[model samples]
Target: MTETQTTAEAVTTTRPTLLEARDLHVEFSSRGRRARAVDGVNLAIGEGEIVALVGESGCGKTTLARTLLGLERPTSGEVRYDGNPLTYTSKALKTYRRQVQLVLQDPTGSLNPRHTVYEAVAEGPRIHGLPDEQDLVSKALSHAGLRPPDRFFLRYPHELSGGQRQRVVIAGALALNPKVLIADEPVASLDASVRGEILALLLRLRDELGLSALVVTHDLGLAWNIADRVAVMYLGRIVESGPVEQVLTAPRHPYTQALMSVLPESPERVVLTGEPPDPTRIPGGCRFHARCQVLASGKAAEAGVHTRCRTEPLPILPATPEAQAACYYAETTTP
Candidate 1:
């Protein structure tokens, strides 16, 4: 492990939490039934920390990100900023929005084709009635790595490359001088060659501006490369969370292990047999039991973990002071 490797607990104790979600749950009416998109999630991002929220598609990572940004209201629970619960009233939300900006997955769809980079980046400041708009926009563009900002100011979205377009979107968010950024798959739509550049820009912004970020992505490799911590979500719940190295290099939860196993560079692959369970009708005990390899391996019974894996709801608790996993057999298994 490198010197940069720090435990989640250490980070928590040393730095202040900039944004947090406590016992958050989001549900929607689907086919006359309630579908839970986020269920009982507690997450915190400390100042200047880049925490990666990763899981497969539809695992509720994006939904959680939206809730944190106040874009989507939670069915239950509350979001806090600087240890105070958020107020979602129109004015309160507006002020909160200024402090926490969102970066969408698809920059092309998010940015208007007719709008020039200047207009896109200035929109937030204009809405908030902030003064010095032009100066702020120029600084934002520069901060996002679009040097000689005036050259790109009049360029339309369609006129720029994919990476440049994404930078413009980031510049728009930075224009607000937000303390936190909720980035939903920030590089998912860009070319592979440009992904590293975008990721580097995020790190630079965090280091230079003391910005904290909740990066919602499905790429484990991205987590390893840039994130200080990684939170693994499954069926609307966080199954495992800890420092990136601890969680990725030695995953405890069966679900997290399965995800890591599928990474192309992984030497051992653990292929799951079934699709993810339906969110509308989540399992009774462990939501992952239906697809968990550790539980079905017939070894858990010997390890004395069979009963809880089948009948008890496993809460996300500390497997160690710095790491957590919501699996009854996590400590017993070697995954």
Candidate 2:
């Protein structure tokens, strides 16, 4: 199918459940130590929603993306595309690969130094054996806001600025006419000014192309600005997730609140104590208890909180119809 036709078809069709991950567990084994990077992460992305996975470094956001893309195999749990289990050798995997593309944070590093911009964008369609490579590359470049697309076609990666390189990376992904786009810290490397521009580009692409996206970032401000929904990850688990406004305005999980409080204010700053616990040796009960001010505030301790926070695992329960948090106190506590 032509790129235009494929895009149009995706738009006209009722929004499909593009991706679903349930109880995903990814582990790394080394020298008698097993580290679970993603611990039972359950998430879904509809056809056109932009879901942001926000967390500190080493919280497994990148690992989750790799698992979803079939780059890394999960030790347990399932990743599905369009309701079927995703396997490396399955036909669905190839189809999913063609329909889902990723934009990495470091565009310069991600793009091959040897390949020109045109070659980079055309690579996806060429590898997938899609007909009409010329048209697809042209459309991709245009869609990515690289005006006079032909001007950039022959330029090497080193020739472009950081923002331009990122634009090229985005164009390469768009070339596939992907149904789902997973951007792993797409703006982390850019200048402050360019970050907004790239974010605006992503937003425009979502609106104009009707693309669903899973954006992984450590920046809550970025998530608040661009994501439709946000999932907060802590210690390899999703501690809280909900609509962007609800989660940001009134976070339920203590970890989420701590993260929100750390956002820079003009004159006031909220100090967070302690460091995130080691994933390899995760603390019992609530993984965040040591750093949670609320939990340390005598009230939680006096409420006869006997189980866990030091022993048992807590269930992720619904805080409201639209939101859920992996904390026993989420439903009862008002944030």
Candidate 3:
């Protein structure tokens, strides 16, 4: 992979922190079986910054997003917004809900067919008792790139195309005038031709509104295109995270390197490999041991697979000037 610059150096800031999660864990019990969807994840999103959470499906990206939104309760750990503990019933939570919104993966599933675009977008303002509902809806539609705005006002979810429906969802989120947005696979269902356009809209929203975002996706190229920071997750854990360029170009974790290897160079390239392991029966320690090529290249036996990756979970250690990886063998440039 070609080396690239770090996002930290690309953007100038005073290290302003907007949201933080400390050792967050989310667990569930189904029919006497215990499963931990998120395990001891730590993350921070800075003001006006876009952070991308990239991982395979079932890696807990969506679960983590739900937890952050206060839609799902964590089994342990803490979530803080602007340094205050998040509470679902607190007065601050009402304010926080208004300041934070989500754009779900399936626009059709989330949107109501009974409501028109105008009603859908205006719902937030109406529920929150914000003044000037009509004006806010108009502004949201315009901001979402549905120019003229009148054309989309009477359209239903089925009346609009996939991309158009997604834009409506974004407009609805924007109507709340949120300071932070959590987009879970916002462009996953759109056609290739429309994906870039949607991504551009998101970038525009960030720039024009000064909004911070946590975009959850499995596409590295998409993350490269829009994210300021990239967090690579594996088996419910953040295996590698830091500035987008640093994590992509100079990956520290073996799992991260493996993920990047599959990205096509242009539009026609392919990198084939086995699928990731089952989350329910995740391997001990690293949880990525089953698919780690470096670990399976005849060196694992000598290194003792159980000893290196099954006994003790590795901590996320600093691997570069501005990055961290949770692999014992992660490379570092300095030292």
Candidate 4:
């Protein structure tokens, strides 16, 4: 891959953090067993920065996103916004949610078929009792790239194309003038052809509005395409995190390497064997040891790190301005 400067590095690490998850943990009980949905996660999103939380389904990315949006309460730890810790009171949450909006995965399900574009976009401000409803709605549509904003005002979601409906969903969020956008699987529901447009639209909004976003997804390729930095999640923890170019170009963690190798662009393939991740029974040492290609293939033993991989649990590290990995054998991998 050609080297390219990341958005954060292009400027400096001095960018103010807009949203943060500090030592965050979330747990759920079912069948008398506890499932660790989020485990000691610490992530920071800088102002105007785009961070992709990449992981397979059930890796806790969605739950983490929900925590960041104040939808789900954390069992331990804290989520802070703009340097202030989040409070759970109804009034406080209401005020907090106003500045931080959530954009869901499927736009079709997100938009009510009954409401026209204007009504959908105006819903937030109306609920917040904001003035100038008409102006807010129109401006939101324009920002979302629906030209001749009035053209979409009276149109129903079903009347527009899939991409247009998603834009309407975005317009709804834009109407609130949110500083941070938490998009859960933003392009997962769109056709491949239209994904680029939506991704490009997000980039434009970040540049034009200084919008900081946390994009949750299972696709590494999408992260490489749109994010300034990437955080790889496994089981319920971040295994590796850094700039998009650094992580995607030369991933150090075996789990991350396995993911990268499966990309269509990768010349060699590394298939992992054994049971899929089970949060309830996450392994003793490395949560990923059971499925780690390096350990399974005896590379860890060759490098004299096999004992550590099987018996030593790695710490839940932070994901941030500096690149780091939680794996002890990360340096053993060829970069």
lDDT of 2: 0.82
TM-score for each candidate, following the candidate numbering: 0.93, 0.90, 0.87, 0.94
What is the C-alpha local distance difference test score of candidate 1? 0.86
| Residue ranges of candidate 1 with Cα displaced over 4 Å | 1-12, 317-321, 333-335
Measured by TM-score, the strongest candidate is: 4
Quote the positional error of residue 304 for candidate 2 in Å: 3.5
Best by lDDT: 4
Q: Residue-wise lDDT of candidate 1 within 9-58, one digit each (tens)?
A: 42253368888877788999999999999977778898898999999899
Candidate 3 on 53-166: residue-level lDDT in tens? 999888899999989988888888767787677987767667888878999888899799999999999999988899988889999999998878988899899999888889
> Backbone collision count in every prediction?
0, 4, 0, 0
The window of 10 residues in a row where model 1 has the poorest summed lDDT is 1-10
**Model 2: residues with Cα > 4 Å off, grouped in runs:** 1-16, 90-92, 266-270, 306-308, 317-321
| lDDT (C-alpha) at residue 182 in model 2 | 94
The sequence of per-residue lDDT tens digits that candidate 4 reaches over residues 1-335 is 11111122121244788888877889999679999899878788999999999987889999999999999999988888987889999999989988999999899999999999999999999999999999999999999999899999899999998899899999999999999999999999999999999999999999999998999999999999999999999988888998999989988888888889889989889887865577888788888888888888887899998998888877666545667787868856545
Residue-level lDDT tens digits of model 2 in 1-335? 21011111111122456787767878998568888788777777877888999999998899999999988899877787876778777675678888788899999899999999999999999988999998999999999999889999999999999999999999999998998899999999999989999999999999999999999999999999999888999878788988899989888887788788777752334456777776777787877877776666765666556354556667642212267787756645655
Model 3 residue runs over 4 Å out of place are 1-14, 90-92, 266-282, 299-306, 316-321, 331-335
